[model samples]
Target: MSETSKMLWAVLGAFAIGFIVVGLSKQEESPEQKEAASMIRNYVTIQSMANQKCPEAILKQTGEEVYFPSETVSDKETYITLKWVGEKGFKKASCTVYGTLGGISELIIDDKVIIKKKI
Candidate 1:
C-alpha cells in the first residue's frame, strides 16, 4: 500500500476510536446530572401547572423563585422537594412541590393543595 494510504487509514482508525470512546462516555449519565435534569423537569411542570391552575398566584415580570431543598432516591422511586417563596401578585405566597422523579405527586401553594396525583 502507498504511504499516503497507510497514513489515511491510521488517522481514520484513531478518529473511530475517539468517537467510540466519546459515545460510550456520553451514554452513561451521572446520578447528579440525572437528578438535576429531573428537578428541572419538575420545575417546568410546576410552572405550567401554576399558570393553568392559579394564574393570579404567578408572578408577572420575573416569575417565581424556585429552590430545591432535598432529593431522596430509592429503588422504587425518587422524591424531590422544591420550594418557591415570594410575592404572588399582591400577596406573599409560597409553593412547595413534592415531586417524584418520573412524575409529580403533590403541589402546595400557601398551604393549600393545588395538585395531587396518585403514585
Candidate 2:
C-alpha cells in the first residue's frame, strides 16, 4: 500500500511485540521477587502508619538510612521489622502480615502496640 500505511503497520506490530514481552516477563516473576514485593508493600504501610500516628518517632534522614533487619515468612504469617534510631534512643516498628495481604495483623512502634488485630 502507501508508505504511511506501512509505517503504521510496523508501529502496531512493534507495540504488540512489546506488550507480549512485558506480559511474559511478569508471568515469570520468581517466588523471591513476589515475597520481596510483598515485604515492600507491608513496609510502606507500616511507615505510613508511623507517619500518621507517631510522627515524632520517625526521624528525618535519607531514605537509605531506613533498615529492615528482620523478615520471616512462615506458612501462616509474615513478619517484618523496621528499626531506626531517632533523637530519643531507638525507634522501631514491627509488622505482621497475614493471608496474602488480608491486612496487617499487628504493628508495634517502639514499646507501644499501635495495631493489634485478632487473627
Candidate 3:
C-alpha cells in the first residue's frame, strides 16, 4: 500500500533469506571437530609396534633407549593391539622375527612406537 511499508517488507524478506543461507553453511563445521570440542577431552599417546615383526626390532628400532611396554593387549586379527606402556612394572617381553625385520607390533606395552626410525 505505502512505499515505506513495501520497503520494510522487502528488507525483512532479504534478512530472512540471508539467515537461512548462513544457518545452512554453518552446519558444515564437521562432526569430528564438534565432538572434539565437547566437555570431554581426548589424549593420544604414541606406542611401539613391529606392525607384526620381531621383538628385537623394538630394541634395535629404539637403539636400546626407549621404554618397552611391560604388559600386552593384542587383537588376534590386527596389527595394532597395545593398550598402555611405559608405566611402572616393566617386564621381560618377547619378539617375532618376520624375515629381515624383528620387532613387536602389537606388544600391548609402553608406547607402540619404536623403530630403526619410531613410528
Using TM-score as the measure, the top candidate is 1
Model 1 alpha-carbon drift over 4 Å, by segment: 30-32, 56-119
Question: Which regions of candidate 3 are displaced past 4 Å?
Answer: 31-119
Which 10-residue window of candidate 2 scores lowest in summed lDDT?
55-64
How many clashes show up per model?
A: 0, 0, 22
- Model 1 is weakest, by summed lDDT over 10 consecutive residues, at 68-77
Clashes of 3: 22
Pairs clashing within candidate 1: none
Evaluation by lDDT, superior candidate among 1 and 2: 2
Residue 2 lDDT in model 3? 100
Candidates ranked by TM-score, best first? 1, 2, 3
Better of 1 and 3 by lDDT: 1
lDDT (CA) per prediction = 0.51, 0.53, 0.41
lDDT of 2: 0.53
Model 2 lDDT, residue 117, Cα:
74
List model 1 lDDT by residue over 16-117, tens digit each: 999999988877788999998887776666555433433333333236643332232222223434444545432233332333434345555556665566
lDDT of 2 by residue, 39-77 (tens): 777666654543343333233222223333344433322
| lDDT per residue as tens, model 3, 1-30 | 999999999999999999999988876657
Query: What does candidate 1 score in Cα RMSD to the true structure?
Result: 7.8
Cα TM-score of candidate 1:
0.36
Ranking by lDDT: 2, 1, 3
Each candidate's TM vs. the true structure? 0.36, 0.36, 0.27
